[model samples]
Structures are given as C-alpha cells and as structure tokens.
Target: MNSAVTSRTLARTDSVRPFKAGAYGFVLLGIGHLALSAAAATATQTSERRAVDTVMRESTFALLGLERTVLDVFNGMSIAMAFFSITCGLLILAAVRHAPALVQRRTAFGWCALAVSLAVLVVSVLLLPPPPIVVLTVTSCAFGLSLRRATTVSAHAAEAA
Candidate 1:
C-alpha cells in the first residue's frame, strides 16, 4: 500500500480496537448480569415452592395466613423482572457489537449501562440483594471510561499527524 494510505489505515485500526474492546466489555457485563439474575430467580423460585409446600402440609393457612395467590404473584413478578434484566443486557450487547460506526459514541452507551446498573442496584436493595449486579455495573463504567480516553487520545494523535 502507499505510505499515506498505509498510515491512515494504521491510524484507523488503532482507533478501532479500543472501541471494540469496550464493546466486548459491555457484552461481558451483560452476560454477567444475566447469569446473576438467573441464579437469584432460581433461588427465589425454589424458596417460594418450599414455602408453598410447607403451608400446604402444615395447614398453617390461618397462623401465617399465606395465600397461594400472593405467592404466585410474587413469583411471577420476580421471574418477570429477571427476564427484563436479561433482555436489557442482551440488547446492550447487540447494540454495541452490531454498530461499529458508533464506537465514538460508546462512552455514552457505557454511561447508560452504568446508570441502569445503579438503578438496578437501588431496586435490588429495596427488593433483593444484588452484589453481582453492582460488580458488573462498575466493570461497565470502567470500560466506558477506557473507551472515552482511548478515543480522545486517538483523535489528538490524528490531529498532530
């Protein structure tokens, strides 16, 4: 290749890799959140089943006054929330991976992911414990900051050249 073309190509590649890495980091973060949510849902479902069984066997409908309807609703809500969290994770991964042109915009995406994760953490505190979600949130934020820094450095280098 000609010198000018070669240099330009190299510059583009240099700018691209960090963004790709950042995108993959988001994917990993999503996967981590999905796994954690699934684990929590399973544990919660199992516990609910046990409670139902205990109530049925012990005939404590009056003492504890736990109704099947209430248990079912709670279980359904938990499962629904888990499903929504998984869907959001998948969507974030897909969005970043499919749109390479948006590499420069990855910082914004990362921030969004981090914000959502924080919101999830707050909700988890009110409802359930989610240490894994917190971990993933921090991880996503780091990747985002890395992407922004790399992009800024590349832009400066390109300007100097």
Candidate 2:
C-alpha cells in the first residue's frame, strides 16, 4: 500500500506481463493440441473402420491414391502445425520462467509472434479437416487473446510508471 512498495509491485507486474501471457498461451495451446489428438484417435478408432472398409471395397487404389495424396498433404500440415505449437509452447515456458522481466521488453513482439503462430495453427488444423483440430484452434485462440489482454494491461502499467 505504501508508495515505494506499490511502485515496485507495478514495475514487477509490467516486467512479467508478456512472459506470463505467452506462458498461458502456450499451456492452452498444448492442452488443446493434446485434446484434439485424443479425440481424433478416438474417432478414428471407433467410427472409421466400417467407413474405411466400405471405401476400400468400392474404391480402387488408383482412385484411392488421390485420397492418399490428400491425406499425405494433411499429414504434412499436421506435423508442421504440431512443430510450431511446440515451439510456441517452449517460448511460453521461457516467458513464464522469466516472467515480467521478459514480458516487459518484448510485449509487442511476443504478441505478434503468438498471433501469427495461432493463425498458422488454425489454418493447418482446418486443412487437416479434423473436428478436434478445430476445437483446438478455437481454444488456442481464446488463450492467445487472454494473453494479449494481460500483456496490454502490463504494458499500460509499465507506462504509468
């Protein structure tokens, strides 16, 4: 409540804002991805066998080759998305560990990076055409927004100082 203590607290808060936002974003993104993977696995295991059999019976390999190619493209996209998500997660971890200090300095940059990363992730998930991936993308967007808000608050506080 004292001026000195208040100032110190504000300063500290500002310093860690971005890092905390990044961390939260990463955690959310990771959880979303894991959830998506689990759901996809479950759907594939439970519902796809009959459909796959039907497709196999009716479809020739040459025709199926196109399906395979499409799937291959999706697989590559999924892999890339996963990699980017992981990288974002790592950055979040770094931010969390360092907190306000890391956040204060790179708030804008961090936000931009997360926004782009999330955009790419969403596109990748859409390309895969998985319900779970879509869910993950939505959840990740929510988290990313939350982080952005937090960083903004922290930046404002810092500027006030």
Candidate 3:
C-alpha cells in the first residue's frame, strides 16, 4: 500500500508491456517471412517445371534471357529469406528471454535493423513471385510495430531513470 511500492510496480509494468509487444511483433514478422519464402519456393518449382515442359515441346533453348535469370535469382532469394526469417525469430526469442535488459539497450539497433528488413521485404515483393502480398504486408506491419514498441519502451526506461 506504500506509494513508493505502487510507483515501482506501475513503472515495471509499463516498461514490460512494450518489450512484450515488440518481442511478439518480431516473432510474427519472422513467421510471415518464412511463409513468404515457402510460397516462393513452391511457385519457383512450378514455374521451373512449366519451363521444362515448354522447352521439351518446342525443342529449343531460346527461352533463356533476363526474365529467366531474374526468376533464378528470386528462387535463390527464397532460400535466403527462409534463413533470415529463422535467424530473426531466434534473435527475437533471445530478446524475449532477456526482456527489458536486452531490448532496452538495443532499441536504436533494433529500429535500424527493422527498417532495413522492411526495405528488403518491399524490394523482394516487387521482384519475386506475386501471390504472397499478404505475407509481405503482414511482415512489414509487424516490423513497424516492433520498431514502435522498442522506441516507446526505450523512452519510458529513460524517463524512469
């Protein structure tokens, strides 16, 4: 019932809420990235199969060009995205374990990382297969949320100090 105890409790609660939100947001972003990669992989396989069929029917090697090269790059990128997503997820899990301690000091770094990731997501969506717009959108939103939460938590922690 002491005022000091109540203030401490409130401060702790407020500090934790943003960290929790940011951690979950990062996790969701990772999951969405993984899903996008999986979908891209499937689409790439299908397209490759179709290309083989067309080549067989036409009996020509004339289908090689910039478009084909771009598709191949996109295919490779899907694998890269899968790895990135898993890595981000693990990092977020670690942050969750450490909570305020880990996230509090790295708020700026986290924001920068999220911004870069969002930019990559946008570029990938533009250059890659088309059906996973929802995945990209969700991932973007989650990263934005994570950045917002990190900023809020960092500001609150500074004020408390």
Provide the TM-score for each candidate, comma-separated.
0.47, 0.45, 0.48
Worst 10 residues of 3 by lDDT: 7-16
Model 3's C-alpha root-mean-square deviation from the true structure amounts to: 7.5
Say which candidate scores most in TM-score: 3
Cα lDDT tens digits for candidate 1, 46-130? 7667887566555523326654455455555655665665566556556656764444433566556556656655665576546
What are the lDDT scores of the predictions, listed in order?
0.54, 0.55, 0.55
Question: How do these models rank on TM-score, best leading?
Answer: 3, 1, 2
Q: Tell me the tens digit of each residue's lDDT in model 2 across 1-161.
A: 55554443344334344444444555565566666765765674645666765554555334544544444454456566656666766776665575644444445645665566566567766564564455455545544544544546556677889
| TM-score-superior candidate, 2 or 3 | 3
Please identify model 2 stretches exceeding 4 Å from their true place.
Answer: 1-18, 44-68, 95-100, 106-108, 117-161
Q: Give me the runs in candidate 1 sitting further than 4 Å from their true place.
A: 1-68, 106-108, 125-127, 143-147, 150-161
Model 1's lDDT to the true fold?
Answer: 0.54
Write candidate 3's Cα lDDT for 36-107 as tens digits: 667754674676678865564554332455334444554556567656755765676576576654444446
| Superposed model 3: Cα runs more than 4 Å off | 1-48, 52-76, 102-106, 129-132, 150-161
Provide backbone clash counts, one per model: 0, 4, 0
On a 0 to 1 TM-score scale, where does candidate 3 land against the true structure?
0.48
